[model samples]
Target: MLSTVRRLGVRGPAVVAIFLIGLFAIGCSGAALQGVGAPGATAAPGVATGDAARGPVEGDQNGSGNQPPAAPADPLIIKTGALSLQVTGLDAAVTAATQKVDGLGGYVSGSDRSGDGENASASITFRIPAARWDEALAALRGLADKVLTERSSTEDVTGQVVDLGARIKNLEATERALQAIMDRATEIKDVLSVQAELTKVRGQIEEMTAEKGHLVEQAAMSTLTVTFSLKPNPVRTEQQGFDPAAEAEQASASLVSVLQGVATAGIWFGIVWLPILLFFGIVAGVVLVVSRRFRRAGPGDDTPPVAPEAGSAA
Candidate 1:
């Protein structure tokens, strides 16, 4: 009986004691009944209370409780930026900057030029070895003019990292707890509940793990937005040839102006005073002839009336 009770699990010891008590009570009751000469009153035969006493121990309270699992720390938040520059020149500077990064085991993430005309600017996202971000920023400043602008930022991911770690740990603990329940569970409903909870906890763990991974990645690599301008330096100024197309357009406009001037001259010559010029010419010619006739006629003042000279007398 003792061995069988022991095989019954955690509640076996207490159940054995209770069964012993019941037996003692029954023996005493039987003896008294015999002594008093009462018949059929010894003790009612009943199922042992030990069976009811056998149950799960307080396993959850003290056995498994330990110091709570600590969460993994998160990476810090970091950022940087620089002056605007020409895209072509950006390669050299970015190369130089990233070289500094490589020396520090950093890398570039994004690079692009945006807009057109003078509004154009180049932006690059680079990562620096976390330990050497300050050195990298110093190197980046060296690539710009006056460091026209500079910025740095930090976000405390310690709390968030710890939080994610805690959440993930909690999910794992919940999974273990559910496994325990699942092991002992007999009812289909209890099994189903444990399975569902375990599945949910596993999913939560995965999600938290992914989040923590992303945070770690971001923290491990520092973000730097490098903006550079093709510095207007005489030393590095590249001589630019005149735009052929613009020159051609200007030539065309000059030709058009010449044609326009010719057209204007022609119009003025034709429309300005040709009719008045003809009138003045005719009047001058008449005056010259009359003067000549008068001069020929010497002292004769009536020389204009001498037109009927030869055959028109009839």
Candidate 2:
């Protein structure tokens, strides 16, 4: 090396310095690339080891790395049913249904009864907890002598609920952004514009929130409508024996109805028709008398036959 430097003379030291600088630069670049490629070499200070070493979880929120798993959401379902029953006694059935609803942590939302005795019927609407819906139905059915009709239906609202939640969240975020913009706004027009947008978004959020609440309530509770009616009396297979008293009573009623009709007709003839007929009869009599007098005193007869035309008699 000393010999080669001596041969190179003046340029040798300068070249040596340049080569050394290049080698240093190359070494630094290689070291930086290695550090970047290594897993933990570039981790910031104060970062937890567990966090740095951890990978993204399967259900991380928003795909953010290293987030804890989220809990699963419950399914939402709306249940409704209707039942028609024929009972021996309508009032008794209604009372029993009320008691059953109360026992099952439910209440009668509406009740209506019409008619009385064997012809009576009742309609009852119940709000029952979803968990005890089937139990309540069974208990209510037991109160009736016979079930005339039964209907039940269910609706899944999980997707709707989830969609509402996402929409609300997005609206809220937009509301926050608008609020921030309004707070920083200086011009009146800008503030007003932001306020209008904010108001619209808030209104939508409120409407959706109320709808979601209603859906949740429906999912949590079920509605059941029950109609209760008295069982019909059995039709007689044998012909009923004749009863003289019943027949006589029916005949009497018919005779009384006929008499009433005759009386009504007589009253009309006496009070209304009699006066009109009397007035017409008197007027006709006067006209007939006048006509007879006029005929008996005719002009030629009253003149004594005008002396029978004297010239012609000669």
Candidate 3:
């Protein structure tokens, strides 16, 4: 009977633990759905939502329905700009840009200078307060001799910020549920399982929290990249009288080159080509002499008396 009672005791707590986990799961899902469907359900801390989250009423005499949705009170915008300028001096332009950014409550993030003198150029990256983005750009432009190019862009991440806030909220609820379960857990296995789940939920919370913070920081600051290049130098021409001494030196050099070429030709003919030509000439002369002797013998010399026929001699 004691053994049977012990078995029942173990099974009772396990059943209760399973039932509680199921309840928590259902609750978390319902909360998540409600957060998604409800307007301004899980707004992040310090975010405004009064007019931004409200939609226009139907059949309003003020024609509110015909109007567009209201913009977010605290919109998250990532602003960036690029400017190319032709300046008289790289160092001076860079210095002026630095001062301008600082005066506008901004700071230089990075800077690079390459080449020198007429070919000098500089690229500077600045992080400016979003409120002062336009001011910083104008100030930097004023330091340039000419504006080569200018561009600006903005990105809205309000949706992502809101979504992260919702997820972090849901995860926190899950964590609380897990903590409650761990506190009520009587069996070692139940306790360990709850602890593991709690750790996972906390980790997710930290990650999402960090991501939201980064997005906020980016929206608060704007980035501007300014490139500075030296102004082009003007063309120049020089006029001067000819020099007799330089002409004389050039003429002497040409004459020496001609003499050297002639000498090289003479050496080649004597040492390399002359022997081959002489050998071929001697062979031709011998062949001609033999041919002439044969011709003279055949036409001019008397033919030897025809040998008498044997029968005529008898």
Candidate 4:
């Protein structure tokens, strides 16, 4: 009894893992085997044996052996776009956009409004059907006075979608196999272990299923983000559309700026150097005044001006 319990504990997870791995392998092998056997299906060597073993081979409606019509191809493209529009009125533009999206059998996923009146703006995100994406874009453009920005992108998720589908199918198959194992399990401990594993597997299946659904939705619907504003876009005045008056105005502004700069420099110079200049000026003036007084006091010595005559006076 002890040995059996220990063995069950050790091998429980391994068995589950192996079963899941086998299920996945089988899922993958079916597609590969179908491809390989399609050519051999009608070949001489295999035809008799294949038909006898398979028994009453299923054929097309008209009794032809040809395969039925293929399923419609999935686009698997996640399309998205961004548009920036300047409109005459934000509220009116939003209203028009809402109507257009509704008419296209789509919905506004999100929206935001900001400011008021002329300063008003709006941001809206839409989930438009892939078939109507072009029409919706054109309709949105008509609501705008100017198209500020327009951009679009596409992501091809064909491989991811296929992979997710395969994974989900494999997981589902594993789930069924686990259920069968649980039904056959007689030991309480074994049943509990299997139940735990089954729960885990179901969780994984649910997750994968959700992921696949999201992928399908994204591929079927295209996302559009539009921004609307009451502000009019500035007209583009190209270099070739040059105006002489504009040029003259710019030149005048430049001249005024230079003169302002000069005046500011002059004011700063006075603030920084005026006190030093005043001190130097006062010192020079005093020195000149003192030197003149000294010349008069020492050289004159109460004597008047010296006189020159042609001959000595008696």
Candidate 5:
């Protein structure tokens, strides 16, 4: 009975005191408690902090804190030229053009020729530094007896170069992101997937890098193709008395020229078909001798001598 009464007193006093304290606290801070979550009320500390963290910052959306790089002062330009020239001697013109290119810190990239002497023509391609393109072109033109065709072209590649730069930057960024993902991957499937994406991105990056290098190279060097044609030299005639010595000299010179032409033609023929001709000639000679002997032989020699009549007595 004493334990029961003690428990009852303990429960009654605690309940009464909590009720009186709650009533007193409500009277003092009732407004603040009601307004805590009201629509027009100030947000709680946790909610305000969350909203502040999620809000956008003041700056450009591109996320780069710095400005873009400035464009180049000079546009990336590739220059090319084609020139046709008439000259007295194609060989001399080719030599002079090559020497000029060498003097200007350039090199001959290609050379081809057709015909000979008066009808000869040469095609020479030179790679000259862009800085000396004009000077080199002018010098090449000056080497000709007459300029038949001259053409020059300039291509601006600034847009392509700038595009490559931007693309490379974005790809590099993607590569970094992919690398991070790959590092964090745990499962085999996840690793394989990330590796494939990384490889693709890296391939694109390499291709664009190579393209940029090619563009830069083209811009640095200019191509010049010159065609050199040889024209016949003017002939001069001299008038003088008809002397016997002069006539004999002219006749001898004419004879020599004819003989030289014939010798040249024979030499070329032998060089081309001597073996085939000799084989055919040998076969023809053997056939001629055999035919002559057959004609001279008696009819019995042509007939195979009737096979000794089956076993005719010896």
Candidate 6:
């Protein structure tokens, strides 16, 4: 080797360049053989091919942390029920309603009762098992004095649940890929980079898990609301004053009133007033004729008696 260098360079600058290039190539080939120089070594298997080994390994799948967390379970669930009623004796009604809900595998989330001292009402929010939701609604209906309002809503996470499953699978794959990179990483930089990626993946997994848990809880349970009002019971009063004389007078008065009404109606219908009207009309005409005759007679009207005296003499 020294003889060859001596021949190429007593100072052959090209010889020096060739020797350096050859040394670099040898080093690179060695690194590749060791799996250190290959881009495949550092490029994430999950990013490239989504390998189960490279993507999701056993424990870190859900992103909780290195401790193989519990296998992913069903998502959480939430349930709600709301109702409004106008009933009497709100205090009693609220208690009864609460008890009913509790007996059906439920509990109250909140309660309120207030009013002026003279009048008051109550409201409550209750949670019931999803399994008993329908029964709970029926129970509330039965207890309603006057059902003012009722409503409920549901979200089907079935599709969401299926999608969650897919997301979890994807995250788990990413976690496995990170784990592989971490395990295989010989360089400190590579190790740190993989750890950062792992942390991000874990965070994402945690978020999804939390979301899924909430959905599952909602699916598993339901919520209920009960509102009630108080009102006085209807009462019928008994008359305290009874008078036999009053009773008799009332009956007599009633008879008189009925007769008078009949008479008035008969007059109105021309049954009684027709004759009176005719009589008045005839009298008016007779008076009118007499007035005219009397006016014409003047002083001569008194001399008619003379005829009577002549008749007697004959």
Kindly list the per-residue Cα lDDT of model 4 for residues 1-314, writing each as its tens digit.
22323444435544544443434434542342232223234322222232233233222233222221222276578999999998887778899999999999999999988887668889999999999999999999999889999999999876666655555544554455556566656788888887886787777778767887898899898999999987655787877877999999999999999999999999988997897899999999999999999988784457777887758653
Can you write out model 1's per-residue Cα lDDT over 169-213, one digit (the tens) per residue?
Answer: 334544554465466666666667657756766776787789878
Q: What lDDT does the true structure give each of the candidates?
A: 0.58, 0.68, 0.69, 0.69, 0.67, 0.60
* Shift in Å, residue 195, candidate 5: 0.9
**Per-prediction TM-score to the true structure, in the order listed:** 0.49, 0.55, 0.59, 0.58, 0.54, 0.50
- Backbone clash pairs for candidate 5 read none
Would you list the clashing residue pairs of candidate 4? none
> Regarding lDDT, does 1 or 2 come out ahead?
2
What are the runs in model 3 whose C-alpha is more than 4 Å off?
Answer: 1-72, 240-314
Give the clash total for candidate 3. Answer: 0
Query: By summed lDDT, which 10 consecutive residues of candidate 4 come out lowest?
Result: 63-72
Better of 1 and 3 by lDDT: 3
User: Which run of 10 residues does model 3 get worst, by summed lDDT?
Assistant: 45-54
Q: What's the lDDT of the predicted structure labeled candidate 6?
A: 0.60
Off by over 4 Å in 5: 1-69, 235-314
Q: Which is the winner by TM-score between candidate 2 and candidate 5?
A: 2
By summed lDDT, which 10 consecutive residues of candidate 1 come out lowest? 29-38
Q: Compared with the true structure, what per-residue lDDT tens digits does model 6 show for residues 1-314?
A: 22343432324543343334223322322121222222334322222232222232356455332111232354344556577787766667777878888899889888887784436777787878888888888888887667887777766565555445445545655465446446655666666665776787677678777877777776876767677776655686986798999999999999999999998898786966788889999999999999999998786544545456776888
RMSD to the hidden true structure, all candidates: 22.7, 20.5, 12.0, 12.1, 24.0, 19.7
User: Which model, 5 or 6, shows the larger lDDT?
Assistant: 5
The sequence of per-residue lDDT tens digits that candidate 3 reaches over residues 182-243 is: 66667776667767777877877898789989988888989889999999988776667799
